[model samples]
Target: MRDTLRTRVRLVGATMAVSIALLVAVESALAHEEYVVDGERDVAVGEFLAESLTDPFVVGPLLAGAVLVLVGIAGYLVVPPVERDVGAFRAAMGEYRSYVPWLLRISFGIPLIGAGFGGYFISPAVHVQARLLQVALGFLLLFGFATRVVALLTLGCYLIGVVVRPILLLQLEFVGGMLAIALIGSGRPSADHVLQRVAGTPGTLYGRLDIVHDRARVFQERIREYRTLVPTIVRLGLGSTFVSLGLGQKILRPGIGLAVVDKYELTTVVPASPELWVLGAGLAEIGLGLALVGGFFTRASAASAIGVFSLTLFALPDDPVLAHVGLFGLASVLLITGSGPYAIDRRLEPVETEEPADAVPEAA
Candidate 1:
């Protein structure tokens, strides 16, 4: 039962995913903490705010924490044995010249750290338990200690935040990045790397863990190859969403599209009837969507998406505008990392049959 680096990473990833899923379930269960202020009384909000003190809400964090600990142990034990070299993938990643994944993590994590600290310090004046929770989890992430556990908690906290101020829901974009870090480790310049080194990674613990490092290395490499498809999946998702919305304009929500033209009174400004304007806009949306899903002209399409979403934001009222800011972030990211490895762009490159030893799996 010796665990290779590949096994360790996979186990950690699965554990984190399951833990987050459990946390989401728990969060939903306690989404609205009502209380029996008087015997058999139900009040959504009260003068005393007693709901937070009730048994179910009180135990939510404890329940989530317990579940993660169990998941961590179970994940450590059941990571499927694989044949692969973790270093080989690392080397391949470096050789293939794909540092966008790492860059994404670093960029996302750094700002989040600043925001977390900001929230932590500002929270005490209010004497709210939520801010204290934010502070504790913030420190955990800042140092990368039990990274996934802290990330899941942070996500749970944000979920609660979204409940309190529904406007905060857009901030879940930040949470998605945290969850990614949780599943993938802190991605260099973090405590996880230092700890791995101290443990004599790929060596001292090998005999104790009963892992087949050689086979695991091979398995890890296979995962690395397939991993390139991940970004493509996201790209296609962005495209498909636009495509669906555009189609919906024609069939389901034609009036909404027409309203955009009429509400703005673009008939004289743009020299087009509302019907014609809506039709053209829908076509543009569909074109952009096709380009994105196909992974063709990635940068242009992503940039266009950024423009479209941004302009759309201006026309939207406050609530919808808040929700859309996340979409803008997603498009911004796509603009930075176009098409990625598994894309139509790849087919245009010279045939590459030789798999390099330095290939690294994309961060989960």
Candidate 2:
């Protein structure tokens, strides 16, 4: 019994070490190609596809690695972690439910503000700027003043930008983050909460003059029932964004992706051909996106998304950090919330009698 336990511990440690090494190896190739590539393809389309898709060196390892990962995941599902420990973790994460609004605000606000000052749209690749509009919206969100309204306003602006410049679609996670804030409303440590408290007090000066307080409260109450959809909305938004980037930018536009790989000399970093780098990155992103979209192993997928974002930042310093901020925040939200309703994970795992402790509860 003792030797079996020791062997299991060693196996777990070795698995972790190998996983980390692989993650680091692919970090550079996994970065968003548009951030660095000038989009002029030096390689021909036919050659790039043939080399990337047909090369045995790349194809064999990718297939083998995927099989190993899937088998490991299956084993994990068959024998999940200790139930008591999982429960404790869930309870610990649950305590932070009230802070979701604040997290969303900061995640998006800083980036918007930076974008305004940096003279770019939501993405660094898009150079057009609306400093005043973005700054105002960002500030209001950060202050948590009229949060839901501000979030809606931000969404409107993003949609407008998308209409004008389709490239803004790359930052689609903003829609999810904004919609989440709109649904959840501002929690504590916000101007909304402070004013609400003041308006409720009998003798407060501001309370006497607060004309819209009661209406706003009523509206929030009315929408509270649908707030449970926050995670689902977020998953769709982020997942769609990922699929777009992977399929539209990388897979369909392999020339541009290959250009990025060559320009950065990324092949040297991972010792893979430029074709393999581009293809692998695109496929990895698509896989992650599909996982989120299906809500299969939702929490793990969210965590992987966050890790990918972090790796992208490190591998390509020129990649606009601001553009990824909303995505990072949304993934963080998922990490805390887990799979909400309509998740495959629910069907696979025993459906808890109650929601997971991490489910985003109604905001205070």
Where does candidate 2 stray beyond 4 Å? 1-33, 42-47, 81-85, 353-364
lDDT comparing candidate 2 with the true structure: 0.74
Per-model CA lDDT versus the true structure: 0.47, 0.74
Q: Put down candidate 2 lDDT per residue, 1-364, tens digits, no spaces.
A: 6875565445334433432332223223333326676665756556767777688988977898789879978887888766688667667766776677889998899899999999988778678767998888889888989888899899888767766666666777776788778878877678888888888889989888999788887877766555656676677667767776776677766877877777778888899876678778888888888888777888789989989999888878677777788898888878777666656877886654324323443322
Residue 48 lDDT (model 2): 69
TM, every model:
0.45, 0.85
Report the C-alpha displacement of residue 245, candidate 1, in angstroms: 2.5
Clashes of each: 23, 0
